[model samples]
Target: MYSRSFNIKKDLAMRNEFAKKALDANPSHPQTNYDYGLALCNEKKFDEALIYINKAIDMDPANKDRFEGFLPLLFMAMRDTENSLKWLLKMSERDSHSRYLGWLSCVYAHIDDLDKASDYLKRFLDERPEIKTLSDYRKVAPAIAKNL
Candidate 1:
């Protein structure tokens, strides 16, 4: 709800405070930790966010698939292109049919690896021919298109 508010900053701050309180009250709860970590991520506190997020993942390894794809985006948000690429690669290895080929291209583009980016883009297009332009890319992966 706060994420879609008119006063986004204020709402996000309020949401973060509430999430922090919940986290403090339930330190071992995976959902609480995940919510707090997500709030911190929204505030751009990447390093701190990582601790809680990783803890939540550790506590719930059975659901790791729910976050594996998103971890690369989080690393990208932290401007850790290497880690982003590594995570994306790991995700691809884990699930070849996953919708990350385009994300791979975007990450490569961010690192100025146009050749790899083009190759990945071609692969992505082969899988998703409907995404033919920048607008389509933005709709699917805006964060990945940040560098582009």
Candidate 2:
């Protein structure tokens, strides 16, 4: 509720406060940990967010796909392309959705591996040709918007 409300109102401070309180009450709770981690990430505290998010994934391995999706984005936000690629590769091993392929293309582009980038991009386009506009590309893969 707090997270949703924060998203609606764009209230960072309030969201951070609520997330912190939730974490304080149940430090090991997966959802709370993930929420707090998300809030920290919004604050650009990537390292701190990574700690909580990793804990959340560890506490609830069954929901690893959810948590793992964030890992690559976090690394990308930190401009750590190598780490981003590493997490993206891990995610691809577990899931092969078209969205993942699009991200893989972006990450490959970031590393100047245009061959791999073009390959993944081609696959992604073949899978999701509806994605056309710059806005659409930005919405789906902001990291690769330039490449698109």
Candidate 3:
């Protein structure tokens, strides 16, 4: 576990440095902005991550789907449930995948919107019936399942 943690940190440091260089070379490039934003998120720099992620979304509106997931995650990391729910709802509108439904359930549960949470959770379960247990649900949304 210690070695795994150390390796993850080392890998993220390397990726962060590479992303920084890429962003410096092309500050307005959408892909560079997205990569740098993701690297910043891995570094736990949520504010900086959101800036670049939003920039990426603005520069490439047609590819907004690519950047949507990061926004909610950064907001969640910052404990800003309103923004998280905003982005997650946008993501859900864009994609009806079980993964997004699961995220919606988790975020709604975070904000104590149990009705929405349960609705999304039911949708998620309907789409992912292979998930057979509470432990399986925990794998998707640990904190939310704990509340349920």
Model 3 ranges off by over 4 Å: 1-10, 138-148
* RMSD value for candidate 2: 2.9
How big is the positional error of residue 74 in model 2, measured in Å on the Cα after superposition? 0.8
Error of 1 at 15 (Å): 2.6
In model 3, residue pairs whose N, Cα or C atoms come closer than 3 Å (at least 3 residues apart or on different chains), thus clashing, are none
The sequence of per-residue lDDT tens digits that candidate 3 reaches over residues 64-128 is: 88777667667778778898789878887877778778878878887799999999989988999
> In terms of lDDT, which candidate is strongest?
2
TM-score for each of the candidates: 0.80, 0.86, 0.79
Worst lDDT 10-window in candidate 1 = 1-10
Steric clashes per prediction: 0, 0, 0
For residue 108, what is the lDDT in candidate 3?
A: 82
For candidate 3, the 10 contiguous residues with the lowest summed lDDT are 1-10
TM-score of 3: 0.79
Provide the lDDT at 65 for model 1.
Answer: 75
Candidate 2, residue 108: Cα displacement in angstroms equals: 0.9
Order by TM-score, highest first:
2, 1, 3
Q: Please, what is the whole-model Cα lDDT of each candidate in the order they appear?
A: 0.78, 0.83, 0.77
lDDT of 3 at 106: 78
Tens digits of lDDT, candidate 2, 1-148: 4664785688888888889998898887998998898899767898999999999999999997897788888887877889988998998888888878988987888789999999999999899989976578777664423332
